[model samples]
Target chain A: MTAPRLDRGQRPDGADFPDCKRTFMEFNVLPGARAPYGIRNGAGPRRAVAGMVASTYVSGAESEGAYTLHMLTGAKGSGLPLLSHSEAHVTLYVLDGALELVLDGQRYRMGRGDSALVPAGTAYGFVMTRARTVLMAYATATALDSLLAGAPYDGFIPAEDDATGPADLLKGDFPGTTVLGALPEGTDFAEALTTLPETSVPYVLEAGMGERLLVADQLFTFVAGNRQTGDQYLSVMTQGPQGDMIPPHKHLLHDELFFCLDGAMRLKAGDELIELAPGDFCFVPRGTPHAYQFLRPFTNMIGWLQPGIFEPFFHTLGDPTELTRYPQTPAPFRFDRVIAKLDELDIVPLGRPPEAGA
Target chain B: MTAPRLDRGQRPDGADFPDCKRTFMEFNVLPGARAPYGIRNGAGPRRAVAGMVASTYVSGAESEGAYTLHMLTGAKGSGLPLLSHSEAHVTLYVLDGALELVLDGQRYRMGRGDSALVPAGTAYGFVMTRARTVLMAYATATALDSLLAGAPYDGFIPAEDDATGPADLLKGDFPGTTVLGALPEGTDFAEALTTLPETSVPYVLEAGMGERLLVADQLFTFVAGNRQTGDQYLSVMTQGPQGDMIPPHKHLLHDELFFCLDGAMRLKAGDELIELAPGDFCFVPRGTPHAYQFLRPFTNMIGWLQPGIFEPFFHTLGDPTELTRYPQTPAPFRFDRVIAKLDELDIVPLGRPPEAGA
Candidate 1:
């Protein structure tokens, strides 16, 4: 007699593997496959929080209460009072224009691709230095949710040329959020921002500096790592060639988040496929089957994995190289070598081999 | 300060993983990656054994003394006496022409892609039914190596049109090979070879008749599985789309053997890359970094993994489906799901990602 059929997610004997928990949520798609897991194109629900258009693309609920992602836009001169989150690690990546940030009695100017991390309970605030300055912020758990709890606004920030002027700062009694009286003054902006040692103390990484490593054809630059975040999360900038990669696979213990920085890619979640462009974001919770195919050469993506256990996977698989970027024509790589370490690396092949990629 | 540079094959702190054992020996490559791990093209040293040209492509030294692979060619009507291996499981896959096997007093004919398994100590023998008939045979451990001990012959076999008749059977006092008198008589040829239950009994899977499974864009047909071989090995015929697949990976405990059945694929082993055509074979021993890219659409490859511990990986990752062939356009698959199961499965991704495939 023939052996019984084994279904997907089922054992050979017909018993189902434990069903994966769906803890993360996704935002509504904004044309094509664009969603919070991809470029938002200034889309998503917005709130007027402290005089800025706070567009929350990923809420705490979407990240299993680990973090929330928001795109904050404001006109030049827009500023906020010094404030702190009693229990949140806040990280910001400047996407366009410039901003001045004050932390620990020091003032620093941040521009495109620049990033800053504010530890829990650290008093910090910022002022837009260039018109239409945009920042992508991720605050742990519900801290940003509570701080951004304000009146809903149509997703529109009055341009510098508009006469409507900035919107009023909406107020709410948000837990864990403390708004200090006013912004600190008299701290001159440093000529340049220097990255501090990885620790709970606040620090910033310049536009193109971080812990850099090359593995195969991809260059991974870490903006914030386990040591800096106390094992809460890892933020990395990845640049690689454009093509279908990784194949169908899943993670069981940690959630993964992706924010496109440049170029485009097609992502496969379960049976669903979507295309992501610059500014697009995607969140793949633990247990979700996902794969990606870059659509253009040298696709740049920002990736975050929660709880930071998989950090060793990259270090274990990568070689220390002096090269700072992916090679134009990478030498052939051996997937079988990686297959040999599946148990230690948490990478399972989803029956889909790379040959299936178009 | 930046983190320390992590070297390839080294831990983040610079410690090396346990070096993998090199147990399999490879035959000399012939005009490309065309070694015994791939198509042989009638190359390699040969022995005239039991009236057949036995070309030992993969020796016991090559498989960690686990198994050996040989290509046997003989003229039509050439036969062997009933014999049995005392401690070896023998398997045969007909590649060209036809073979008639007699086991337990039952005779059967096997054509291209047809397969048979003879359990250890089981009595069996075979005769070439078609001229220039070729059969790929594998015997556990050194059993076949001992039985095929004969005078080295210039790798040539007399054709049906040749004036010289078949070479006289070379006599050898081989251990574990008990030639039991002559071929069993009065055993009529069975109308068809029917596969027996998965057990330690002689059985045959007629061409195109085996346990077929579709996972992603590949169709895996199992001729001899773990249950049938007492967990010694698994023999599968795989058909999939042509492209880079599986990525750079490694297996720490199991050795993999590949033989091209049709079409072609490029294999990356360490720093070397080679293309394989039909009849080419590749042996990727444990801990070797390797990946494959199919050069044409719908490449067919025969794969065997020793010890059979990885069988469950396929069952776990594959869905029971009615489709008997790979889909022309397979739906997107998720490699992330597999990545999540890295600890459960033995697959470890080399630093390379799918996007790196050329």
Candidate 2:
């Protein structure tokens, strides 16, 4: 096979060259392949609302209810309607220009190269002092979509006068958002901030590779959970040694998709058994019993569960071990309590426990 | 702002958290803001074939014409119809079991922890040796959809005899794939391999922060091009000092999207001038003349060009200098030749050169 070095321009009578394969062995080392997320160009459909033009780059329909990514281009002197999301947090990053936000009866000014986290239930509105473009991310899917219902312009809308006023757009109270009137008199910025209701602020975990939770023989990293994303789906990455297996179980309200990042695994979905390797993907729909065992020395997989409310199961069942728990021995847990917790999470166990069974 | 540290559970009388403000001073050090891509769960609709089942996790409609990601599960005694793609390269990663591929008069067996690249225009067929599952990626938009037309079973297909065979499935040559007969006799594996045509193999650059291509005052990393991903788009990451600019130009065949990874940039698209800071995104549709100037020192941005055919323009126009070119001095190029090459790539230069005017 190594004897003949075919010339670059040469073509055989009947043979064809195969395309080269680029293996993502050092997954994180490569800048492009290190991330599995898709990019939605912000150049999609846009809607005009008063002085602001909003466009969605990523909708919840595509994010598995994780978040909705959108852009707001505020024309000079334009602003969004005074609004609040009852259940969703909004994070805004100013890309250009400056914004003066009146939130909770206090005024705050944010300029270019700034970001703000608006906690859920916070009443806030902003006006662009100069023509500004802002990238905004909402923790909930339908909050923004519902708020800007009929304002999307099919094509580009010039920064000219519009008939719709911000107040008129908020005539009907939205489910997650509350429309408020004017600010109260003599409101102090610092005083108002301390008076505001305590809400869970959306936080981005800047976890390094060394930061991970070890549960028994598996090492897990919680990427995004309901607490941060305000969505039901949780994204988790787990690595385990060979022979590590999870008992067959089914979920009631959540579906899961597992992406094999490294090594191999034997997965049993219902009565069907399938094998998975790196770059492989498997979807275990809701109510479909499934279990998997690592078949290689080490197996790394990313799992996403819709309605990520079940993440607490790991916290309750697993120990908070360090990240460097390789060659790990199985940690014992109370089987009865584990089984009961699974039941509470709507997970029906179908097979024997991991250590006791094959 | 620091005076009042309200209790975690305490609520103010009438105020709420306005929002937080975090500037990307150290972009990568920030946990949630480093990666710009979104994750796609591999849990979508599934269809059963004669002796196997298939499902799609990420479709092309979601990835902006980049790639279609999917999976296939083959049962015992099950096989896929012999097929070949005309315009899209198919990369398969074996997740479980084993696959026997019949290609170019040769038989290659691959098991779990293995992968293969099936080039376009090559006739190939595969069968599962045991119960197997494979994850597949197509470099084209609609090739896989066209080949698997009307053969998807809603539920599981038992591992029993079926009427559909390889020939029956390929009554007509599909748009991207062709069905073929068995390999010719007396073909030597080594001889055939040598006789195969020579093609450019896709390569990955494990470039560190220190490695980059310096073209004048700008530093670029050629992330992905036609030789690597086959088609659709080219991804490039570039960084430069403040005042670094690209002259206004428009492409006739490809749209361009810019993702601001760090720092700020002033972008002019058509008649609109928008300033983009970190976490911001902008799209310049094909035929829309645009240019950008970095507004801050050490500004970095990721650029994606649809159809990815013009990536060679950079290679042709710029000299391949060392990666460590910070505080880079400008390199001059022949304007007449550069303009001619731009015209060849369907790029209409509408503004002055980067250093000549602004």
* The candidate that achieves the highest TM-score relative to the unseen native structure: 1
How do the predictions measure up, each by TM-score? 0.44, 0.32
Model 2, A1-358: lDDT tens digits are: 0111111111121111122121111111112211222111233346776556666544555445545545565545566767778776665544444556666556665543234556678887776654223434434556876665556563222233354546555566565677775333332332112111223453222111222565555777654555644555566667665553466778877666665554556565655445554434555657777777665434566666667767777776666654332323455543455566665666777755544311
Candidate 2 lands at a TM-score of 0.32
Worst 10 residues of 1 chain A by lDDT: A1-10
Off by over 4 Å in 2: A1-82, A87-119, A124-141, A148-175, A179-212, A216-249, A255-285, A288-309, A321-341, A349-358, B1-358
Model 1 regions more than 4 Å off:
A1-358, B1-39, B159-171, B185-187, B191-196, B331-334, B353-358
Could you give the CAPRI-style class of model 1? Answer: incorrect
Cα-based lDDT at residue B98, candidate 1: 63
Q: What is the lDDT of residue B230 in candidate 2?
A: 59
lDDT of each: 0.63, 0.49
Measured against the true two-chain complex, the DockQ scores of the candidates, in the order shown, are: 0.01, 0.01
